[model samples]
Target: MKHEFTVTSILEDARKKHDALMVLVEQNASVPFLYMDRDENIRDVLYHLYGWHQILSDLMTKNPIPPIELRPGYTWKNLTELNYKIKKEAESYTLHEVKHLFNQSHNHWMSKIAQLFDHTLNAAGLYPFTAPSNLGEFIHECMGGHYQWAIQTIEFHLGDPYLRPLLEGFKSLPEVEAIVLGGSRGKQQGDHLSDYDIYVYATKPIDVEERRRIIGPHVSLMEYNHQFFETEDDGVLNNGIGIEFIYRNLDDFKAMMERLFNGQVNRGYSTCFLDNLLTTKIIYDKKRAYKSLQDTYRFIDKAALYQQVIRQNIPLLYGTQPNYFDQIVKAVKRQDIIAVNHRLTEYFSLFFDTLFAINQINHPGEKRMLEKALSLPKQPKELEKTVGKVFDNITSGDFLKDLEQLTLDLIKLTK
Candidate 1:
């Protein structure tokens, strides 16, 4: 509840805390989050803060301080009824709508704050409407204070049992700039089979021994410095939950994001890191650098990147001499099952990149491709059925021809 009231400090704190809360909201929105201290879900918390943000905007902009109510017939004193109405109204909205409304109102309120001078913000009675208290105080309570409360409230319900102790141990290392919960767990879509995919963003590498020493107590089985893909530690928590500790240099990760923002496109998995960052929950951020990066690129326009992703990946699917379709044809001709599977995997990667681009959604990583695609607003009809058929008949005589038709169907959707 404590906050700095200086114009500069309050503004920075407001933005930082807002970004943190947004990340938290995104992480927990998919799951049922009922706060024990109150009868509220995540949407209730979001619309509650959003309602206050709207009030703050009105208070700052309206010259004579127009009458405001918690609802039509309610005042601030009718707190319980006010909250009930708010929650009831929010029940009609989807999670996406509530998040959008909250985010937009915050931005609008911040813009109003930008127009105020320090004297106007920090001095009492300068704005007689907020008498006995300065605008800065109201700003703190509405924006920063309210954000912290919402964050803590939702986090209270969504806390992971093993995450707290793990974060405590990792926080001891100076080299760890930030730590995040990534993959399905971070996205709030994890089932029983899902693991805790932890990403450690560091200034420099934490020695393997140090990592082992830190994570050993919490994990039953631990593997150190596995370079199967990224350099990471593989472990199973004492509670029998699988967790991965993947290391990344903070600076290099920033550079990768910069490249994506500037339209650098990979043949496949073009926006994997972008999706990962947006979906991650900041378990430990030592210097606040990770949150800053999240704020910078959170709303980045990926129109160009999407086009580049489709352009670079779609061609490789077919319609070229050495395309995936042709490669599959040659592999099938040789009756090489391994080669066929390899080409099929690459084919789907390229296929999905184009699919996601055309739909204007970030690629949601490697697992559950058909499910992810099917969830998108726009996608080829019978997509899952076709994909299932291709895989089931991978050894059938018409495999290459079936794949070509599928590629052509996907290409038609892009056009």
Candidate 2:
């Protein structure tokens, strides 16, 4: 029988447990850090985790590079063990000491990735580790997805008050036309709103560079672009920047909202969180802000549905939530076999379903490529056999014997 689970439910449970854990950590006498696992310390390790995962995943299919051997003494364990290893290898220090470490590690990995783009390496390397040519398009997926997870986990456990102020600051910007709070918390379904995911619509199309200056140093801007209203036959609107800016004024904004309400207007494809909601916040009139807020809520409800479809179809690219695979490894280390088994099943099911959905959605020309990349066989029975083999491997305890084994298996399979 197939197991059933909803992302919303998992997020909600994680939030509740995280909140409870935070309270315990605060009131307890011995624990020095707010989080039991010292998650902050592990940021560097997390970066490396992402790097290795991305590299190994590419190696498995595209380039087939020799697999890197896992270091000795590392083994599968519970979340605590993973955190301990991260902390142990990490330079000793308090929260203050590690604040810069995250950035340093991030830059280090980025630099390494940059090297893959060098002209000499581009042609010779087995697989380039850098992001795609359209970096702007992909960066949001990386930052938004990961940060959403990090913020949720941190807010649940750390209780940071800074989140609200950060959001309020964004809201205060005059240029922002609509702001959508995406994620598990947007619908108030018990998912923790850790990081603020704000979608700021400007009245005028600002140049990417200009938008950067406007957003300034406080917050890092991910992706910004001018969107054109278009039609299938007439083609995209070719209005100049000045005209586009003029069209974004209060009157045009109201007209746009009215069209949206009457089902006469539609926005382009967006992978953002707000797509799941049914409606969105509209700021047509400055005096009637409350009405705009109501509309915004409905718009978001509609958008949420869209988000669900995207997740269902897309390859598992990024997640901020504690790496479920890593968590399983940690559980094994702590000798929590039951917990490891349960989580492993949950994660395996999610991945399988996600990949299967991607296969179903494959475009005509891309079907063969995807099928080959995913190792799907031509025959239905063959596909079942392959899936069964994967399940058996997951059930086997050989990978759980040590960190090295676990990492190797994960790198091989997840890739």
Candidate 3:
């Protein structure tokens, strides 16, 4: 059996419709308004989606033989309630408050997911279901398909001019490799007006910088890297740089798709660029294709730790730690299941400790202590001015001094 995966067929109609909508929206000063309003709205919607899935996963875990009809209740009313709660939260905030609210809401939802997964595992006494299967699978499906839809929707609403250039550039890559789009936009938004975040794949490493030069003035190339990996007893795998091109060749395009389907190659990390999409540009040789699905999977897992540090630790250091942490602790302590659910307790507790450690490390004069806490293998030259510049950027000198006090306090507390 042959599986046919065509990016054009999947995206074309939505892209065209979205472009029309963007044209309409751009008539007035609605673009910025849409951008601001839609950003939070989309995030709220995704949280609700994730919440619905978490609830359903929990329900299924609690009862192995539950009726399928009960699933609707888990989604509709629950999502509605969450939507209301989010709206209410939004209402109480000033303009400055909205930025962090998104992060807080996301963290809360992720915590709920963790709890739901824990309960599910405990109830089943085994991992439930398989890939592209189960309640989580439903959520995954929503994330993959609906997310793209949302991006298209946003693009239609905003009518941003970047979409055309992105599409044209995508058409220019080689024909056989895979293009995997990742980062924030790839994960969330699904609209045509959105900026394109694309990763083009190739069998042999191509000249990414040269391609960027060819794309020229219309596209703005942000960051590009040529990744070369040595395969075990096989030749090296060369991937071109990140490009914002205006055109692509047919052969290069097909090659990109084949490599993508085979999981032969990939682009770099996508944490920053939230709106990117993979184009599957070229496949050099079919039989010589490499397999990297496992590697991609592992990278995602490892990336979670980095995300945790960013989402939880860095935010805490930045004075954005939710006061809800204490509330969570109180709620967990009140629950009779805490002692029985040692794993959950331990996991959250470790997360809490890490958060506190990060806070302490960022405390004033902590730069001196960072040398000790980080325990880097090599001792680089001290750059007090550089450290000071970073401190100033994040907070005033007072915060830096407070960090120093916190570090001393931590040392005493530990001793």
The model with the greatest TM-score is 1
Query: Candidate 3, overall lDDT?
Result: 0.35
For model 1, residues 1-415, the per-residue Cα lDDT tens digits are 4333677766787899999998887776687632121224788788888877766665566633434453457655456556656666777887789999988888877776776677767775665556557778888788888899888768755667776777677888878898877888777678999998988888888898888888998989998999999999997999999999999998999999988877776777888888888768777777778877875766556688887888788778888778988888888788898998999889888999889989887889889888888888777766777777778868664655656777887888877
From the highest lDDT down, the ranking of the candidates is 1, 2, 3
lDDT of 3 by residue, 1-415 (tens): 2223233322343345434433433343223322222133433433433434444455546643422323444333244344445445445554334434433543453444444442332232233332223444343333334445545545533433544343345345554344333222343333433333344444455465654453444443343442333111111112222323222233454455445334332221111111122212121223223223212322232333333333443232223344323333343446534332443233333332343333322111111244343453322223234334424533222333433344233333322
Total colliding residue pairs, candidate 1: 0
Model 1 bad stretches (over 4 Å): 1-158
Q: Quick one: best lDDT, which candidate? A: 1
TM-score of each: 0.65, 0.24, 0.27
For candidate 3, give the lDDT of residue 186: 41
How much lDDT does each candidate structure score? 0.78, 0.37, 0.35
Instruction: Compute the lDDT of residue 82 as modeled in candidate 2.
Output: 46
Higher-ranked by lDDT: 1 or 3: 1
